[model samples]
Target: MNDARPPLPAPPRPVRRAAAALALAAVAGSAQATDVFRLEGFGAVSRSMGGVATAQDVGPAGMMTNPATLSLLQAGHTLMGGLDLVTTDIEVQDQATGARVSSGHHGSNRGPYVAPELAYAQRVGAWTFGVGAFAQGGLGTEYGSSSFLSRATGGLDTGLDNSSRLLVLNIPLAASFKVNEALTVGAGIDAMWQGLNLNLLLGADQVGSLIGASRVSGALLPVLGGLPDLRGAHFSLTRNSPLASGINAWGHAERIGMTYQLRPDTRLGAAFTTRSHMADMEGRATLTAVDGVAGQIPLNGNLKIRDFQMPAVLNLGVSHTVSERLQVAADLSRVFWSRVMKDIKVGFVSDGGGDLNILLPQDYKDQNVLAVGAAYQWDARWTWRGGFRIADQALRGSTLFAVIPATPRKHLSAGFGYAVSPAASVDLAWSHAFREHLDNTSLPNTSAPIGVNHAQDNATIAFTWRF
Candidate 1:
């Protein structure tokens, strides 16, 4: 009988395996992984792009888009890691009152993130194996009554609060084989651990307070015409907020790449990474709310978002040397975010009656990137580097998540490196993103007009230490 599982297909060829490896490695490498205001071009060059070298010569960020990177590590065992700090300015408005207030809780030193990365590479014969750990992306906004949003909800509403963190720890086991004196091919498998925590708040409203005062039937009623139990207005906030969040994810990635020396002083490289089809995203969303007149609700819900594919990416880079003292590079890349944010069917479960299953909008889009950078060796002991990149906005003018409010942006940046010696180097860089403001959630009343404001901005500084 053909019950032998159809004789498992032959293991992929070494070349095929290599390509699969690089693709797998780029699983979470997308524009969404970048800082709030920074765009990629989506994975285009920014400060992180400078950490790894690609044949595109766009500096180091290219490595993030592919796994063929181990081939460029000088030699021996090298370690790289860095930290990034970003901030954003946000606002919410009342369309009814034309009152726009700054969400005091808008931006903080702790957003887009303090992404920490670690990568180590070792050369074995003609092959290179590397491993790394970093946070791809994770963000959520919280708007309290401090802003017009609070005024709109009643005390009735605490505010809008949602937050999550996704960390992708990658262990790349790869081997690079030299195809020729001028070309090298590499492939690897990336084991990833994706962790996330989500918090949400559904709310409730009281009729007594809504209308203020009224006359019931033939008698005068106290405050707003609302009855004691009239028009049960209850907005059960899906408290995505957790008392103590605890969740994690584990997955695999495959990648492949090729790099060739075009000239004695120049090199070109390309990488393809596989996307991740989520088998299942299971987690829990803790909830809290005020029921009717007065009551604090405590709830815990188990959530397994569902299986969804991450997205695939293509990366091409080039690096050229003008002289012994100057080196220049550029890279072009594409991320199928459109696929990543694909509309999907989602389900939510809680102890009692929580979000059963819902179809949330997959409101993301595809993106492209362009990065250019250079490094100058100032002596045997000193080296300097700098670069710039552009990223695109995923949200358009109308979107449901408008309450969270996001605006597309433009970022400008510059940085340099200081080599304490041949064994130690410190790198520092800065970037800023500016977005216009318009409040879209505020559906207007007679006194207000609905509008969307994404007037947001960002400033970032990153520090890297390499040995």
Candidate 2:
């Protein structure tokens, strides 16, 4: 009976250094939201108008929507800063056993996620230049160690953690040029960052099913499959740090847009944003396995996340001033989610020998969004704004939906703007996503029924300075 084990392999120097940098640079909050992991809007003004910034001037925030709107800025240096506070309510239930778990309940506090935005733009001659940082969007959930999802052998709580988090940030350099009295064109480039963390526990049957569908390599599969009575076996992956994601990556993207003046008081706008090109995310993970024959085995490994990227987006909009104090705007957008979110591939190479690859299917569909808004001038120093948005769900009903529940369908918003002085102003907005419910009867390996419900509330405040 030999019980000795070989020493684990060490990651390359570059991977180690990059992982260290990511750990140090990671932020505390996560961004998850309305448009199936994407926020409905970028700033207070845009949000107040149902994210209809394509044809209207929303100040520096336009860099994220339609850069062509930058040409409508007042001729001076303009700076804007904004913060969004989001609170989400998620509930999960085991339809067969009647066991339930809810986010922000039973000691889990995953609400009040903070996302910030900053932008500065300058208008000189016939050109406008802008630079800004924006928290794009992602999906996250946390079910503590005591939840039914953490149950293992003999239906006993294993105290295993089940959680997932993803965050994306974008920094853009944009410029708009006024070609003529009736048209303006704009272009921009974005430096993107993405982070992912996962802590999952899978039963032996689930693991076997994944192995059957996954792209298997290395010499370890033979030994793992030779074991007898795998009914009590389980596999788990845990992160090394709580503050940072287990894996992170960087990427780049480009966008182009234009605004056309249809009439003296009417405008049309359009924008195209390309998909991101990201590198594979790398980090360290702790892999643990428990089996009826092999007992419990713990191994250290390097984890790699492959082919994770954001989808391309196309936006079209119109804005019209009906009277001196009344304005209206409308926008339509298409998100190509099917192209990038079909499947997520993860590979783990243990230190001792061999590697394992797993493919998680998301089967996300393309999403379409429609938004409409109106604004009214109440007085010389006050303005009122209201908006509504509707979007189709991106995920199909399946077990995957229970793991990542981001399926809100309708949103309503209202806000107001106040002029503090001739050179400064403040905007505030609030939005709510109606509750959505989905039942999961498409479990891959098991016949467990699951139900998920999700809803959200968000508030944004922004300040602008003109000099």
Candidate 3:
């Protein structure tokens, strides 16, 4: 018998280091959201009532919507935990090639995406203090390697994966003060972490268009200009590992809010959350230059993502008690997406004196959202809740929009609350976002439009314990 066996191959040193760096970040893998990358609501109570927490007492989740509402917590201590299950149905169609592809969510191998939340609060004298961890918002999608969208080199399948995921998580510490019988004011600071993963392929013409439109004025420009004909070349950023090992960054923001009693049965609330100040997202990426004279060159480099931050938000709301058993609430909010999402700026620096910058335009519009909800007490142990939410789609039809389709425009939700005991309770909620369709009219170098479809179903369950 032959005593010698071939030594098992190992991954390259750079790949090993990249994987180690990503593991050290300790970030969870995949998350999806509604409301153009934001969840329609944070907790079971809030989602059941169409995200109407600005003036309502929804336990420690108030730290995310309106910290002032924390003043409504019962005396002593409270603990809350919740989980959100999200299911998305997405389809992409290349009109020119008459090919269609469905996202991984539609297959039996992939299950619904999950996000978790936890919070604790304490009330002492006229002050309420709270802390919580919440998933702020994100968007993600994945297409299989066999999909038509993964084709390169004149419609030949390259078995390349195409996907993107962006996740934002927030940790907040807040304090609320009861200024009198009728007013409560609160403020908080939030430390946030964001992670992004992308595996994309662009044709030569698309790369050329991006370079032309981008701000590229360095030694790199002359080098790119001198390259051989790029008509058949393609650019790709992909890795052998999974999407979880992409890039991560940390940031912080501030929020202020107030709630006032307009009448014994009516309350008004307003809150403002500042934009996040995040550091550049940095990670290792495999950049491939294929076809043309480049002839399949693989460059290992560090990718830097600049000017990627969440936009500021402003919210105003009113809650009114219609009867001893009935309550209603409404909220209007504005999201300043145009300010932060104008373009995606990325720079790549290779170890061998090669660097380039690319700018992908987003041109997102500010979004206006309206939410309305009502709750009814049923007997002593059960409360019924229902709500509706609506917002316009923010991104215009384009190739990038198809990859990151966060375009749900309307939602219907319903749920119930049950009092398990005097000190413990449970809340359950379900929501559905109707189907939305978009035409990709602005694809680079292609006049034929691509069709994108998206819809969603979300369920949330939360448990609360009060001492």
Candidate 4:
């Protein structure tokens, strides 16, 4: 009777809870949300005029879209910066049942992210030199952990958050040479930084199928009871927790551009950007079994991603002054999406344990963007601008999904600028794109056709100073 009950075995509850908390905090500081894959433009000036910066010498922001435009900057140095506030609403539904696939928390992932712009240029003799920073664009979509899709596989408590996030920033140090009055050539090196986080849910069937692929080669079957025969299984598996595997990479690219004065009143411009190859991403991936295997096992380990590169870009534009007070500009750009994203491969980081490999199909087709705008000097201190743009979708009919479902197709924009003073001015613009609806019936793994609708509204403001 004097036996003091052995101190209650250290409760396993605390240890389990601690492990869960650590997993959630993995991608904490680095998580950034965005909505658009490519921002229409870099600064307020570009945003206001329907992203028309290629030929008309907009400012330092032009250095990013078309470095040759740097040759058009005024003799003095210029500084400009702006912030973009964007909002997106997307809804994905099961085509057959008309039931929503997501949790109805539309655009919850949308955030007011900053698109910074900075540049300084000086003209000496026949050369103009400058440096600047800009954000091209990014994509962000988030769904609740207890979404309709999640519930289909297990109970509401199953932690399943499906989302995607990407952010890119570029800095260019460049020089422009006015070889002669009619022609200006420019070139630069770009320091590009990119970060990405992908968290997706996979059905047991899909995971099982991936295991069957020749690539996996029975290497992953031994894990978690040899990959259950999920063909008819009701449970699901989540790829990884956000913290486990996030990508923070750096790379470089080259840019060359030229502007030729077709006539005193007109200018033709072109710019080319080489593809940037980023370092492979390394992090941890935690795959948890739900429903049938609930709490039975945890597949967590280091993950490695192959080098990912953005597509090369080619832009050709023309700017013409119809009158002393009116100017019109147009640009056409080709993005080699097909070359960079034909296939995406993900592998496991073998630190003392075995790993798995998988290839996600993404045969994206190359796309083009067309933009046209007009700027009119309404008065000595006021200017008005308007423009329109159309961009082909990178993701096609079968591959579109609930995560990052909105791929913009067309945009309309308008704005104005006020001359606060000779050396200082402010610009503002607003843009709206109609909702795009996509129907997916051919994609594999879909029990029912998927339908998605996406719409957006964007606004920007920037202050510029000349010194």
**Clash numbers, per candidate:** 73, 2, 0, 4
Candidate 2 Cα lDDT to native: 0.75
Q: What does candidate 2's lDDT look like per residue over 1-467, in tens digits? A: 00011222444578557544432232112122267878888888888767778888777888898889899888889898888887888888988899998866332324456778899999989999999988887766777778777775446455767666677889989999999999999999999888776667766666666677664545666656766644323333334343256788899989999999999999999999998999998888866665655555666888898989899999999999876556788889998999998877878888887787777678899988888777765545566677778888888876354557878877878788877776778899888888889887653423356788989888989988888
- Highest lDDT: which candidate? 2
TM-score on alpha carbons, each prediction: 0.69, 0.88, 0.87, 0.83
Measured by TM-score, the strongest candidate is: 2
Query: Clashes in model 2: which pairs?
Result: 8-351, 9-351
TM-score, structure 3 vs. true:
0.87
Cα lDDT, model 3, residue 413: 82
Off by over 4 Å in 3: 1-33, 105-111, 215-245, 292-295, 445-448
Candidate 2's error at 147, in angstroms? 1.1
> Model 1: which ten-residue window has the lowest total lDDT?
1-10
Q: Between 2 and 3, whose TM-score is larger?
A: 2
lDDT values for all models: 0.46, 0.75, 0.75, 0.65
lDDT of 2 at 418: 79
